[model samples]
Target: MLRLIAATLCLRCQRVRALPANLRSCATLSSAENRHTVEALYNLSVDIQKIRKLKGWVLHQSPVYVREVADLLKDMGASGAIVARILALHPEAILCSPDQVRAQRELWMSVCRNQTELVGIIEKFPASFFTSSSHHVNQRDNIAYFQSLHLNKRIITKLMASAPQSFSRPVGQNEVMVCTLQQAYLELGGEEANMRIWLQKLLSQNPFVLLKPPEVLRQNLLFLRDKGFTTAELLRLLSKLRGFVTELNPDSMRHTLAYAQDTMGCSEAELRGIVLECPALLYYSETILAERFQGLLGSGIRMAQIIETPTVLELTTQIVNYRIQRLRAHGYDIRTGSLKPLSGTKKDFEMSYGKLQLRRERPLFNPVAPLKADD
Candidate 1:
C-alpha cells in the first residue's frame, strides 16, 4: 500500500502518459489520484487552499506524496500541526518520491542525534530539510568532512539546519574556507587549545562564513593590519564581529573610514579608538553613517560628544530623536551633557531615564536618605 501510494503521487502528473517502454516505467496520476492526494492533504489538517494559492503549481505540475511526506515527519515526531504548517509553507516537500525523502532523512539523521532533533530543526527552517535531492551527495560528503575535523555534533547539526548551503557545496570548496579560518586564528595569536571552541562559536554565529572565498578573508585581514589593528586587537575585533569580519572588503572599509575621519575631523588613531569602542562603525556604510551623523548634528549634538561616546551611532535616527525628545522633556540637555546616557540598549535607556526621573522628583531636604545613611 505504501508503494502504491508512492507510485500514485509521482511528479509524472505533469507529463503526458505516452511514450517508449523505458519511459512507461514512470506512472502517470489520473485526475482521481490527484484528487485523492489533495483530499489526503486536507485530512491531515494542512491548509491545502493556502498552499494552492501560494504555489499553484502544486495543483497542476505536482500532485505530491502527501501521505508519505506527512508519515515521514510524523515518524520523526512532528506534531500534526507542525506537519501541516511545514507542508503548507513548503508544499514542494511532497514532490520528492518516498525513496528520495527517506534517503534525505537518513543523511540528516547522521548529523542529528535522532528523529526528534531533526524535526525540531525542520520546524524552524523548513527549506533546509527540503533542499534539492541533487545536493544529497555533496551534503553527505560535507557532513563527513565536518565530522573529520572533530567539530561538535551539535554545531554540525546547527550548520545543517541554519546554513544548509554550506553542506550543499562540494567538500573541497568548504575545506579550503575552513582551512583559511583556522590559519587566520593561529596567526592572530589564538591558543591551540582554544581553536576548536573558537571555530565552533564562529560557525554557530555565522555559518555563512564558510561560503565566503578565502581570498576575501585574507584581504580584509591585511587591510585591517595596515590600518594598525595589532594581532590581539584583530582577534578581539573578529570575535566581537561574530565571524562577520570576512564579510568586509577593503574598498568599503576604506570608504567608511574616510567618511568617519572627514565628518568627525578625527585623526586615524582617534578613529581607530572609536571603532574599537563601537565596531558597528567599521561595518556601517558611509550613507548610514552620514544619516546618523546628520541626525545627531541636527539635534545640536556636537562632534566632540560623538567622539566621546561613539556607540550612540548604533541607534537609528528615529531612536535618537525619540530619546532626545524624552530627555528634553525631562529638562536634560544632551547637547551639553555626555552621550553615555543615550548610548545603550532600550533597557539601559529606560534605567537611565528612571534614575533621571528620581533625581528630578527627589526632595532637596533628603531626610530619609540622611537617616538611612546614618543607620
Candidate 2:
C-alpha cells in the first residue's frame, strides 16, 4: 500500500516538472555571488602574502598598516581608470606596502645622487606618496628641503661642485641661498674665495659684457680695434660689466654706435663713418631709414614730390647720366633725356618717357634760358 502511494506521488511530481525561468535564474545568480565572494577573499590573502615575501617584511599583518595603505590609496587622488591600470600591473602588491615605506622614502631622498636621478624617482611615484605638500615645491625650495632633511647630502654636494654657467635672472633670496650652497661646495677644496674675488673684479669692470658669448666679445673687440678705441675707453667699458653679457641687438646697432660715440666723446659723423665699415651695422641704419620714410609718408609727404624737387632733380639727373655713360662704356644700350609724356592712361603716360614722344609732361623750368645760336 506505501509503494502504491509513492508511485502515485512521483507521477504527480513528473507532471509538474518544469520550473519558471525567473526562479531558475535567481538560483543561478545566488550561487555565482557566493563563488565570487570566496574567490575575492582568497586573492586578497594571496596578494598580502606576496607583498610580505617580496619586501622581506617579518611584521605580522597589522590593522594600522592596513589602514595606512588604505589612506595612501585614498589620498592618491587617481581616477578609477588609473587605479585599474596600477592594479593590473602589480596585482600581488596592490594591497600592501612594497617595502618598509618610511625607509624606502628616506632611501629615495638619499641614494639618488643628482637632480636628474631625484626627479626620475619622484616622477615614478604618485604625487601623494610624498605625504607632505611641501615636497612638491619649486626646484630651489625642494633642494633646500632635501638638504635640511640631511638626505642624499653627498650627491647634492657632488652636483653643487660643478660651476653653474647661468643664474636665474631676477634671482630671489632662495635662489641666492642655492648659489651660496654651490659656492660653499667649491670652497670645500680651498682657494674658492680667490675665484670669487677674480669674478667680482672682472664683472665690476665689464658689467655689460658679462653675459655675452665669447664670439660676441671677440666680434665687439675686433670692431673696437678697427674703430681705434683707445686703451682707456676699452678699460672703462670693460670695468662696468654686469649680468648676462651679450652682443648688442642687431636692431640696436645704430643706437649702440651712437652710445659708443658718446662714451668715447667722438663726433657723430666720425662715429657714423666707423659704423658704415661694419656690415653688421648696416641693418640698423636701413631700419632707421625705413622708419624715417614711413614717418614721412604718414605725415602726407609724397615720395615723388620729395625726389622731384629742383635741387634733388638736378642731383639725381646728374647721377643718372653718369651711370648711363658708364653702362654705355660697358656696351649697354642707355638713354637719357628730359621727363616726358606719352598718349595713354596717366600711369602709362608717366612710364613711357624716352620710349615714346619727348613732350615735357611736368617741366621743372622753362627751357634753361634758351641760348642764342649767334653767341
Candidate 3:
C-alpha cells in the first residue's frame, strides 16, 4: 500500500509539470472545449493508422491556419466530414494558408461542376488537388493549359475525372508531347486545319494516350509497320480503338493472332486483312473473340460474310440475334449480310436500318440501345 501511494504521487507530479508547458505553448488546448473543437476539424475515424501518422504535424500547425481552412471549406458548402478527410490526407495542407485552399477548391468546383463532383474527384485522386505540388494556383494553371488547346469544358472534365494521372504529368512534358504528336501527324500528310481538328477529336476520344510515354506510340507503330500494316491502315486502326496498342505485348499479340487463325478459322491472308481492317481485333481477348464469332456464326451469318465484315466479331450474342431477327422480320437477307450493321457507326446503323420506324411498326420488337448493357 505504501509503494502504490508513492507511484501515484510521482504520476501526479509528472502531469502537473507537463500541464504548464502544454498551456503555455497551446492556448487552444488549455481549455478542454477548445481542444475538442480543434480536433473535431481534422480527426476522422477512417484509416486509423494513416490518420495517426498525421498527428505530429497537426500539433505544430497554426490554429489560425487550421481554423481558416476548415471555415473556408465549410462556408463553400463542404461538410465537416469532407474537411476531416482532406486534412487527414496531409496535415501540412492546412499550413497552405486559407486563401490557397479556397482558391484550389473553387477551381476544382468549376471543373467538376459542383461540390459533390469536386469531392468525388478528390476521393478519386487526392494528389491532384491536395498535394504540395497542387497548392495555390497550380490547379488553375493546369486547367488553363488544357483550355488553351481549345478543348471543350465537358471534354476537360471527362479527361480529368476519368484519368486524373493525365494532369499529374509535368507541364512541359505535356506541351512537348502535344507538339510532337502534331508535328508527326503533319509529317504524315495532314493539312494544318485538319491536323488541329483531328488532334482535338482524337484527344477527346483517347485522352488516356496522353498518359503513355512517346516510346509507346512509336513502338506500337513500328510493330504494326513490321507486320505489313501500312501507315494509313495503322492510323485507321488507332482511331477505332486506342487502348488496343497499349494493352498488347508481343506474347499477347501472338496469342491473339493464333486464336483468330485457329479458333475463328481465319486463314493467314484473312487474319492479316482483319487486323489491318479492324485493329480492335487485337484489343479483344481470345475469349471475347471466340464468343463474338460464335454469336455471329450462330445467328446464321455465313463464314464468307463474317470474313468480309470482320467487325461483326465485335458484337455480343444478344445484339447479333436482335439485329438478325429484325432483319428477318423486315425481309432483309442475313445469309449474305452487309457490313453496314457492324462496321458503321450507331447513328449510321440506325439511319440505314430504320430501327426506330421498324420498332414502331412492329410493337413486339424491342431493339436494345447500344449503350445499354445486357444482363
**Top-lDDT candidate index:** 1
Ranking according to lDDT, highest score first: 1, 3, 2
List residue ranges in candidate 2 displaced over 4 A: 1-198, 201-212, 241-245, 249-375
Model 3, span 264-365: residue lDDT tens: 576776787977766667777888888887877777777778778777776677777777676666667777757555445556666857864565478553
Off by over 4 Å in 3: 1-100, 106-154, 242-244, 261-273, 326-333, 342-375
Badly placed stretches (over 4 Å) of model 1 are 1-33, 325-333, 347-375
Best by TM-score: 1
Ranking by TM-score: 1, 3, 2
lDDT of 2 by residue, 237-341 (tens): 333332222344433554556644553355765554444332233233444444533543343435443232212121223343443344344443422222222
Total clashing pairs in model 3: 0
Model 1 Cα lDDT, one tens digit per residue, 281-332: 8889988999999999999999999999999999999999999999888888
TM-score of 3: 0.60
What's the true lDDT of residue 269 in model 2?
51
lDDT of each: 0.86, 0.38, 0.64
On the 0 to 100 scale, the lDDT of residue 360 in model 1 is 90
TM-score of every candidate relative to the true structure:
0.81, 0.21, 0.60
